[model samples]
Target: MTVFILVAGAFTGPHVWRDTAARLAEEGAEVRFAALTGLGGRPGGPGETIDLETHVEDVVAVIDAVTADSGGEIVLVGHDYGIHPVLGAADRRARSIARIVHLDAGMPRDGVPALAAVPDPRLRVEVAERAAGELPPPARDAWPRWGSTAGLSEAALDGLTALAAPQPLGTLLQPLRLTGAVAAVPVTGVLCTGNGPGVEMLQMMVEVGDPALRALADARVAFFELPTGHWPMLSCPAALAETLIEAASGGGRRLTAADASRPPAHLRPFLLDVPERARERAGNTDLYLPDGPGPHPAVVFVHGGPVPAGARPTPRDWPTLTGYARHVAGQGAVGVTLDHRLHALTDYEFAAGDVADAVERVRADPRVDADRVALWFFSGGGPIAADWLTGPPAWLRCLAANYPVLAPLPAWGLADTRFHPVRAVSRAGRLPIVLVRAERESAEIAATVEEFLTEAARHRADVEVIDVPDGRHGFETLDPTDGAREAVHRAVGAVLARLKG
Candidate 1:
């Protein structure tokens, strides 16, 4: 039987999950309700010095206790504020967690606190107002004013109010610390569709490019819609139980190349014939060639990242880049995904040289139409390939960059240099370039892309700008949400069209 750990949101205790827990238990699943410190029956009370880490520890302790008792994997479920602590626990114990289910909860990113995740200014103000003076917890009776409890039966409302307690203000104020460990653990977002305007609000945030929401949309997290209010366990216990069961039973695993039963017939991996000088700096390249290849138009795929030193290549490393290469091959083109040596922030010039060598190798492939080769660069790779965009070979047909970081981040010791794309685009030749900008990228990147385009126009470079509505940076690699997938497809199509023309 699967072991389940259920965590309740703020101002609520394990009793809130009584119905859901009973249902799961009836199905022969072992359920453990985690009543966090300062709430439920745990020691500590309101006005105590409870911070986010304290609750994180509380949940981790529960996980450890349950693991000791059951000796099996755990399906951890968190709702509302509970998601923060659960994520912290999961990050600390990644191997012990089978899956994490967020039920109508706020998704917090690394270093972002729960309160800051709230997009509504008025709500934030209200929270601050409520926590003024002694940092007293919000009144339990006022819970209805903060979120929707509509559609809930009278008995459910009574049960919720009776069990609700005061939540620690520090939990919402303290930021979460994550080191990308949670990415290894599968996650599921259970959207409560009937929860007033919460669902629509979340969708709008995603469209506007909220980072946390965008991360939640990652390919790693599968989303399931449930027609219930915020308190689904109280209002729709049976349905929530079923969803939880599905999540625990492998519904949350992100799709990876290893998940493919057979290799794509059209795609094959190859080691580029790198020169002795470049061999040590070069990485293996994956080639996707269509059948009947007679000097086909080709695309060289440049992935984003100043990949850290000592990092080993894995099939999971660049899913989006490899996936896009296959798509290009399906369109009757030679798609080459190359791995170039990455350097520390100070050695970008060396990295760019590696990328240039990779490009040369791709152009030399017998199956490639040397004269019609195009280049596609993503994120950090944009700067490395910017030199080619500026003074591209006459044989180079087109260039495409997706959410490219055109300028060096001076804060990270990457000051403006001759290699900086934004600084060099003005000197670039009249190369036809397509820039795909994610609408919701960081302000720094957005400004850089805009500046690059402005400079390109000033230089009379033929550039086309494509704005991915509601798109996030690195959306291609994240969960395959409809919006993300559409953005990637559109960008690829635009680049292919420019190359074909």
Candidate 2:
């Protein structure tokens, strides 16, 4: 019914789409694979002056030829670096394309080269260094290292590697030029969740109206996730093909501006008016306020890692932390998440002070029940909240921690605080605590958590321990399993129950 044009990423050719195209063809669709200039076994070698514009010409030529032959609408799909040329072509021929699919690829804006989208500074530098010449493909034997071999048979790997070729450096170095017309075509993103953090960060950028991802802001674009590696065609071809068919059929869910502005279905976003001084030091605080009225019990989320110096915190920056905040909000409490300075080894006390200030700001909010507040700490944030747990305020209802560091990390210069959580829990005085321990926790963190729990029990401190046998430290948001979800649900329920009483 529709013509499907597939474009492979750099260093690969049309052969990369062999399995997917075959499956789609069997499903009764017209499929054509577009081998970009200088890619695949094309006559020209990598040194051939093949730039982004040349690739765009290649895709546009295919669109013209396919449309002229069939007179049917076209679905243009681009993977990885292929996205740049496909997007450029779509912008040039917006009326001819029905839908555009970005498969685990970077979405570049006008005037930005594809290389600018690379997130790692070192990788960016490496690319720049190689910009003068052809960028060689990974060795055929190292397919596994490149993620192409995951879930694929040896024969499939051999076939893929044989088809690989050196990519022209010009394609990545050249900037993409667009007149904004491409937004007219419906866009669908089939994201690979194995790179969870990166995808989450992109979603956040879209949410906050970051101009870099403005193309996705168009109402025509939607996103779907596949729980596989970057090369989904090899890892989960069936699922990828099915998603593509759905997108082509206009049956996929759309991502709208309203969806981006609010928290997920379970929670709502709120802006807290922190002291101007606190805002100056730690940016702003985003609160995921639960549904319902009248002063609800609340929890202040202290996220791990002071972000790198000069790196500002965005809602999408720490997916795991933000996800837990939403979960806590879903369970009938206002979940407050803030951004504080990344602490140097000697700056733990200063960081703690900033967190305390955030807590005070949250308590002052009229929507929060100031009398029933709890502190939930994660990773490096654990030591920052130790003071509150040690001698909690009378209004503080409970404390919930997940794979937290109860003792100082001497390596980080986090030591000799007035009250260590392990030593202070004994005198915490009836303050209830819920600790969720990840089975795959680091040895040091596990040992510290063990000692803290032991001391709590010996002192008769009111505490509950929930073990997530299948979870890693950041399981709640990071590699979530059914067990992790259930563990988090129960943990939040416990904290809420205590606050309610």
lDDT of each: 0.70, 0.72
Candidate 2 TM-score, true structure as reference: 0.59
> In order, how many clashes per candidate?
3, 1
Q: Once model 1 is optimally superposed onto the true structure by TM-score, how far is the C-alpha of residue 452 displaced, in angstroms?
A: 45
Residues 457-489, model 1: lDDT tens digits: 788888888776676666554334676666666
Q: Can you write out model 2's per-residue Cα lDDT over 1-501, one digit (the tens) per residue?
A: 788999998688887777788888888889887878778535565446878898999999999999889977799999878889999999999999999998877667899998765543344577788736677776766443333233566666677777788777888899999999997788888866553223343443344344445566566777777766567787677788888888898765454453645553112321211111111123557777777785988888776553444433443245565666666677677777777654443456677877888888888888899999988887656766568767789989988888887875322223335536887787788899899898977544666688898999899989899988767655654444677767877887888899898
Using all chains and alpha carbons, the TM-scores for the candidates as numbered come to 0.48, 0.59
Candidate 1: how many backbone clashes? 3
- What's the lDDT for candidate 2? 0.72
Q: Which parts of model 1 have CA positions greater than 4 angstroms off?
A: 45-48, 118-120, 129-141, 196-218, 252-501
lDDT of 2 at 1: 74
What are the runs in model 2 whose C-alpha is more than 4 Å off?
Answer: 45-47, 140-150, 153-155, 197-218, 259-301, 304-338, 341-501
